[model samples]
Target: STGTMSAEELMKRGKRHLSVALKEECVNKNHVNLNIVLDHLLSKNKEIDDAETLEWCKSIIAGDKTYKEFLEIVKSYNNSSICGLVWTAEYVAYRCRTCGLSPCMSLCMDCFKAADHDGHDFNMFKSQAGGACDCGDESVMDAKGFCPKHSKNKDRSKIEPPKDLLFVAEIMIPRLVVRLVQYLRHSGAEKQYISKMTSFISFLQELSETGDLMQQIFSNVFTSQNDYTTYMISKSDVGVEYDIYEASLKFDTINVNKYFPELADDLIHKTLLDEMFFWVIKSKFPEHLVTFLLSILPNEQYKLAFVEVFVEHYRCMMVELTHSEDKSSVSNSVVHISVQLLSPLKLAIEIVTKFHLIHIMFACLKHIINQARYGNTLNLTSNVMKEHCYWPIVTDFINILAHPPIVQYFLNSTSLVNAWADVISSLQGLNMNRREHDLHVEFETETYYKAFSAELEICSTPLWALLKHLNDSSSKQLTINIVNILVTYLNKWFTENSVGEIEMNPDEMSFHYPLHRYLSLLISNALQQQGMELTDLLPSLEFLEILYLHPLHLLVREFFFFFVFPFNFVVGTYKICYV
Candidate 1:
């Protein structure tokens, strides 16, 4: 009796049973217990030789060998034996039968007296050794003794779902997979169940690879067994009574789209694009189709297909946007269209290998920004960005730039930096009327500051990465550009509120202090390495004088250089002179 014990507990108990069976020399008397022991042992210990154990167990059960001899015959097992043990069915030594409407059915002893299957005739036969009804006798009758329908009839609804999917004819194999994957997530299935379903779907997909059946199924899902039609209409005269119901009918027209106006012809296109982005979400297993597109080196044919699909979609949206005269619709659609266009590009930023790919992506972003700004430029009260909708894209792009891999790539690739910098410079110079300009001027400045601030926060600071590579004088211009960006960010942060004196929380120093600390370290290291005076590291002699004037700056500067500035002498000399 295994009872309700978990697998581990059963294994432990089975090990004890093996010890007893071996020690008592009772293998011939208790073949069932011996079988259970052997199965559990092989299941628990993979090293036990399964072939030897199976042969030995068979021999012992047949009374050809004693327990002591069988112990000596078996040696080890492999992981595969665990599976063999589970699938092997055991014979029931006793039989019980129930008088039911269908026929007499055999059950194991447990079901013979199970109170749930009441008001039925039962007969017990001892030591018969036959297979029991694996479904359990309860399936034939519920608690009230009513005949329960066979599962085929009960589960037909599930096994054969209604073939009522919209655009069912037009859906491709990849599109079907996308919807199913989405369904799997939306269904909230257990991880184990989802894994098994995905594995089965993968198998089906593999089978689809063999030839035309798959292509036909995908390309012509609307076709019935005999014809290519997808929808049917009544053919009997409207007033005539005829027995047309018995005749097999073929589909003639599709009007499901006409009923769903909110999602019209564009709905088909939107569904495809949305499903195409399964890889962007967390739960999706991207390797099969979605992930192939994400790879830095995808198959050239598939890559071209993906690019063409994206470009065509963009062209369609742009054409629609240009024809629309509604101001609010134009403004809202700009953000909406940009979101769709940029999402895949945003995902590619971290993984893209080629600098040329980055250039192309940035070019797309530049065009989107320019088009949005240009559309609303004439209307003084209108603005291009809706903060909630548009800023998320901007924030995501900032996060991508701040990613360590992307930042490291940017530092190493001069073209990547220059390309991105060109886009940033263009954003800064958007020409507009003063009234419209003032409305979003602050927001535009904040965006630039946000970009720089985000870039600096890579693994806590870009300053750390910059300092490590600063020794290479060839990247001096790149380093200067980054420093200038950071300085601009700091200046914007400091001058906010336009107060005469801006007070910063002493405890909040961790957020902003690292910038100054790393910069001071960078300057000190540059001066020491060049074997030149401070004047050489500073942009000009005037900047050197400001550093020389500030005692605190000198102290911080000397500290990173492993020394202390002597500030006590200046105060003491002043005191003596006054006396």
Candidate 2:
């Protein structure tokens, strides 16, 4: 507290703010006193999730001190963020050096107000097209664009830089457009500075978001064609050997990492990088040459790390493709370069799904099933069996599917069960074709339902406690969806297993399994794919068993348990009551 404010009021406010931060964080949770204040600031409309948090964090990392402070205690500033915003603006305003402008420059290339007439692409300006140069402020400052000593020639055109005057606005302005957005919502800069920076930041974001600015700034930051080429060469995969061979030829290229420290400083690893890699692989950048180039560098070099993040991301993208409405384009050099790029982009997808990547992988299997059901005679059985990359993709998918967000998005979706049905259908198709041999063990959908009893106790623990809410009567729809999903899955599974039901699904209609056993099996396989034991899942195997088979579960939950699955898992290997 400051001025007339007392310490007692500050402590009270601190307690309230702390609770709100934990519960509502940045989003409005409608907690009366908290909600009202946040609503006035338009906080209720903001998304409450990891993405928003990350974006907020990035703003700070991008050099907005105000944002970084917001991540801490909002009340830390004497009841206002105004001071913090001004501090942030001053810090970013110093970026003129990178923009290749004089210290007094205020005009921005992003805003096109600071455009230099000389042909210097981000280089030192021939004529000082400094701040307000377009408006011709140079003449006002003596028409020479500089003092007599700096004015070498009278004919030389010049722009006037922003005056280094003592003003709050100068210090509060954010240099980048992204930082501006944060300033608007979170920055407490004075009204004048807010309006000015708001307009400037918005203007720049629209123009700088794409075209030359983005291409120039983000070329090496994220995945690019060259990165993808490097990634694929590292994988040593087939069909795209040219990049490796070609890279072997050009081993003498200078290391940009040395000349440009900025390159090394801004180096990042994220899933989005795959976008650039994907582009490169499609275009087919030289892999062999790329690999040879990389060989000269150390293993930990960004040159190599980029490739790892790319490849891991490639696996993720393929799995996500199942959820997409359309198919991706064919591969080429750009695609080739991208395909074998980094391990995986750690951006938003770095976290593992709570549902298990295996479950999602199984869902993809359903996609293949759906594909097979359509009656295309591509001889998929043998072809799929021979695919090496496909298996790892499936395995990785299963692993990630178990990740918290991944699982939440997956299990919550009705499409998940359909995906599983498609997987079964495809399996049935393969078994019928049996051009080679038996593919997988036949577990009827009912067997899966039995195993689902394992999820009952998951609510009792913290690991997956959030899912415990699904057991509440309030979650009737969730219960029904889960029940119907698992039930339908079991039916399809049994059809594929118990009998010679080798034909494909009837139509484009969504899939539904009807057996408790199959649901259990699906869950079992999912956990296995995640390399986890049943006990590792929250709600404990014992609890899920009771919840799945007990009458209480059906009464409280909207979805009725199909049957009683004893502590004994039908799979026998996994003890439902234990691990």
Candidate 3:
């Protein structure tokens, strides 16, 4: 019987039957081996009973041909007739309206010319990127539009997908789920656990690369419309009326239970939480672990739990570092880890504000500053600061404030002015001890003077920017409060250190000049805003008068004049009595 059929016909038949066998529910559901499915299909089909054809089929089924090689072979045969060509943008392509099953079906010019379309509806257009010839793809083009070479086979009936394939899929998917569950349930060793997790991540990444395959599997096997409806109905029973559109918009909140209910178990949640905490503490791929956890547990409660853990850990570490007498023995690694953990939440404004993270950060700042202020001789040396973890921790908090939402929350709080004033006063108090020769030598040699100046600049610049940001708003009192803080610090600085002291140690001037410049800028900005007047700037002018009388550093005096002269001219010329 096979002797009468052409090789093309026989190959087509074999391909059709193979496609059917692969789609069989039993094969997919039962996870049947390809060889077994091929054997069964071959036994059922008498067409490939001949020894040579049998051997060819068996060779492919037995995995002698790699999947890629098999695919190449199939592609070679499929493209032999029609030009299986792709076109870039601006290239000419043809489409047969009569034969195209979809608008996407296209043909190369050569293939279009080779085919007969004397009475058929066809059109030519420039191709877009990724446009490919579909002349020989039966699913895309009807038989009537097929090129001469591809039209040899007249059969155009639909072939049902095999139940065996579905069976195999069902079986394999559940097993994979079980494997993932087991990985979470049983922790053998750290390396093994990380390896398992990494492998799973790799698998998911690879799966994602297969276009639409993951989506199809998720929709067809993992979840369905029926399941979504059932979940909504269940919610409705709890007095929440089911609104599909709203529910769809909030899919993340409901997806864990609807798409993968098994994963929604309390034990699984606890295990995930435990693993996340462990990884965070271990500092082992914690970011990746948190990313994975957040993807699965999109519930606000879950996020709140994570925030609680991170906040608790952060507080504990800050307290420990502040209190630890041997600063050298204390590790800032955990503190940095907590910062890394909480850093992602900065994007989540609601979570950050709702959890009062800004308040917590301020509390942490005060705790560390208080400890340094009263507990120990606050050192400005680079090595000492590093050992004390002072600059790093403070810088972390400041960097967090750099985020707009966090800063907005900070600005809105009642403690905003006092919190910043405390920090400024603390830095001033700490730097006072730096004036001793040995300490100054240590600071200058280690370049801590420049570093300290940079720290003050970093601190003041953001506050100045925030003041300008609030200049037009009704928060005029806020601006005045901040201005008062700056003026108070400037006054303290001028009265505490003499001009001779400043001249003796220019490095000390360098250490303190950033604050002065920032203060001048703040004052100049405050005068420009509505409802602000010369009277409001009296304290600042008084401090400048104190500066004018003293033989201050040339840069400092020039900065004060540059700031005050314009204000005196523009704001009704309030005469400053330089005492």
State each model's C-alpha RMSD to the native.
Answer: 27.2, 28.2, 18.8
Cα TM-score per model: 0.30, 0.27, 0.42
lDDT of 3 at 348: 32
Number of the top-ranking candidate, with TM-score as the measure = 3
Error of 3 at 84 (Å): 34
Q: Which is superior by lDDT, 2 or 3?
A: 3
Reference-based lDDT, each prediction: 0.33, 0.30, 0.44
> Quick one: ranking by TM-score, best first?
3, 1, 2
* Candidate 3 positional error at 201, Å: 4.6
Best by lDDT: 3
List, residue by residue over 264-323, the lDDT tens digit for candidate 1: 223122222232332122222222333222221112233233443433333233333333
Query: Candidate 3 residues 1-579, lDDT tens each?
Result: 313333344345454354344344243343234434333433322332244443444333313233344334333322233333434346798888788755346787877887888888889887433245666655456767777755647353244433232233333332333233333323321445555355444333232222222223422322233433332224344232223222322211112222222322121213224333433333333333333333322223443455555543444445445444555333434433333333343333543565444444555655554444433224444333445445444545554554445656665554655556555555542343122322223223444553465355436645644654565636566666666766766676666665323443322333344445556666677677645676765674556656554433444434433343443342232233221
Which parts of model 2 are misplaced by more than 4 Å? 1-276, 283-381, 428-483, 492-517, 522-579
Off by over 4 Å in 3: 1-197, 200-271, 274-278, 284-348, 367-377, 381-384, 387-408, 429-443, 447-450, 453-458, 471-474, 484-510, 513-519, 529-531, 537-579
**Candidate 1 vs 2: which has more TM-score:** 1
